[model samples]
Target: MEKRVKERREGLPELPNAEKGKVILRFAPNPNGPLSFGHGRGVVINSQYAETYDGKLILRFDDTDTSRKPPLPLAYEQIPEEIEWLAGFKPHLTIMASDRIEVYYEHAVKMLKMGAGYICTCSADEFKQFRVAKSNCPCRDNSSEKNMQGWEKMLDGTYSPGDAVVRVKTDMANKNPALRDWPAFRMQDTITNPHPRKEIGSKYRVWPLLDFQSAVEDHLQGVTHIIRGKDLMDSTRKQVLLYEHFNWEYPETIYWGRVKVHEFGGFSTSEMRKDIEAGIWSGWDDPCLPTMATLRRRGIDPIAFRDFWIELGLTQKDIAVPLSSLFAHNTKKIDATAPRLSFVRNPDAISVGIDADERMSSISVKSHPKEDIGMRKISFDWNERGTDIYIENEDSTANADIGMRLKDWCDIGPIAEGFSQMTSLEPATELAKIHWVAKGGASPATLMRPEGKQLHTIEGLLENHDFPIGTIVQLERVGYARIEKDGNLIYTHD
Candidate 1:
């Protein structure tokens, strides 16, 4: 197996060095659960672009809203490990978004002082109906001093979940709901919180929204480029506005389409997590699912995945590639290096009679017809009753017409002819394709199915010697096979 670096990169944009040098790329996956194939697509593209531009790849865990964190104590540790595994050790650093709560609070205060944000006491029902009726919050006209007092109460836990929320003072009449004085922070109730931090207590009621936290984090960390799904494209614009308000540079964005709704069967992450907890799948890595761990277990070659997704390039059109395409690409990759072995899966051997006197002879077969050198050794012997030789049923059935040599020994054509000459120790002309192993055969062979099963077979002699394990060779007329031990064969697709 040879390790090769990528010769060309796809989905890379043409930007001047001036533009690229300022780039600091990040793959900020909210590790609420194990990442799926869609995440894999994003990861390779993000890392590839970073590699191409000689920029940094930061692995950020946007683990805010601690209430939704996985209940397992080790979930935090597993998140980074999974990210690193899928990204292939390319991230320059790993940072947790939750660790910067103080930073977000500071920015929240700054926005308040600048009169860019205010507090509201709208209940859930009131807020929903307000939006439907195209009306504004009554607190929308509250003075900054009063709003500040509300925020202070929010921080002191005076406000219950949804008792108060702080929203940016954006236009209420904006057609886009996202821009309608969107809530920057809101108190979360227990029903919405799956695994709230117990030790942290309820000292504070306000929690930053996803987009707001992400916007501030990107600017604070000097992230100059943000690649994400188009679903977040609108957020990018809002983030740009936030940066403007803070007098900071906005990161260039490359937004691709989100995974199709049908692809997910309309199952959200929350649903998937519930399914996982209920044992619907094996801890998010079950091979049945498209999670990265499952993909790897199913024999998918990550490099091929990277190449395929990158070549599709980046586009805003939502599409779902069949799982077959990925499996096919991986099969091609494995075929290039995975050695072939021989094994009779169903265990049907051609039982042909061989004579007594010639029992001690040898057969010579090419180790690998594709490669030109080594040979496998095989010998033949009569049973105590002086009769049969066993060979793979498939080889006999497929090549019955052709009398292929059993290595250096006589060619055995078909089973009928081979059995017809039972008395002679020589193989029948029609049974020339018959493969044989000596009475005391030698060679280690592993039989494998797509599911990684091993098969055992008699050893063959090449140049009067037994073949050793890992002896990749052709069985004269048989398909490619690898000699596992001195006498066993493992079947592979080659």
Candidate 2:
């Protein structure tokens, strides 16, 4: 436990620009899918910075791209729950882009009237040709009045999905072609792919693009800083164009590089959703996906996630860590609390004929070895002759010379091939001490381990186990496990 936590002895990076009780940071994630480790790292740093400065943290859901990544209604609620679970409190504010479409629309109109934007009706193919030539679209020189008419047509259902779009005016000859006449808003046929909000229910067809919507909301919400990935440097630049157009100050920004968590290569929530729909995955909380929901379901403590990101600190270098890096942190938290239990997978019987009932009752072990955690009483029921001790298959031996001991129980010699025999009770001296269930009301169990996004089940029996569901236990020789709400035992990790 000490080793997992003590490596980070230095202090975290200071937010020099943040003022006490005045700094405001926002974690703006698109609500189109579940949050990933990449998304969590951004939000955790933003929230931590907010706490470090005694300021406010806002959870703003950027749900603008309904045409491509439609806003998942469940995510709007789950995202906040996850954030609160991680930060240990509710954010100072929660804003959804869907709820603030009017504000975005107002700003887009303001830019149009300021002659900083125009409506371009160029076909995608034609726009590509113009972009390649570094030439302006035909409508680039149109008056604000004509652009206003096109915008009205886009909103009032007069335009089809691809008929018209609002473009923020930028250099046509810009080296980065993406900055040339970037589209600020576009027409989407909501009837075909509707927004999930039932109240809105396809009422609006003109939607602001993500870059445009976030810039407007940031200024309105008094955001002091932006924490995001270096891949989004282009996004920051795009938002800056609108920020400058409105004479709004761009917030101080800290950009991090992409992180690669091993065992999750090519993981995508959108693709995972389609796979889930096609029955390729179990579901979002499948214990294999890197989503927060899966992490929580697998009994991953939220504090581990917090510490994991905090330890990563404010480095811009891309980090590639194994799943064990996270499990190590989680194990430190649970090692003291998880009770010790014995599970015999594919039971191999070793019949030890003991002397008396007193010897049979000598086996005892605590819930946790050194901690003050409660203990589980272990008692062995007697057959007509003696006690029937059941141990693991690999631990059984046919030789009577080599001594073996039951864990914290009694020392016993292995019986011969055709004879059930007994040895004198002595202090255990063998190097191999095996765990066993005395066949005294041991409960039938199945340990489910997640092996590369698939479930690997071990049919087994747990010894001296009488805990209710949801009780986490360390299966003596096996890894830690959580008794799920469904009464199934699922392995957390070593």
Q: Output the number of the TM-score-best candidate.
A: 2
lDDT of 1 by residue, 244-300 (tens): 778888877877786542323454555667887897755665434556755555445
Clashing pairs in 2: none
What are the lDDT figures for the candidates, one per model? Answer: 0.61, 0.80
Candidate 1 — worst ten consecutive residues by lDDT sum? 447-456
Per-residue CA lDDT of model 2 for 163-198, tens digit only, reads 988988988898998788888888777888878888
Residue 359's lDDT within candidate 2 is 58
Q: Candidate 1: lDDT of 326?
A: 59
Top candidate, metric lDDT: 2
- Candidate 2 runs further than 4 Å off: 1-11, 357-362, 397-403, 417-426
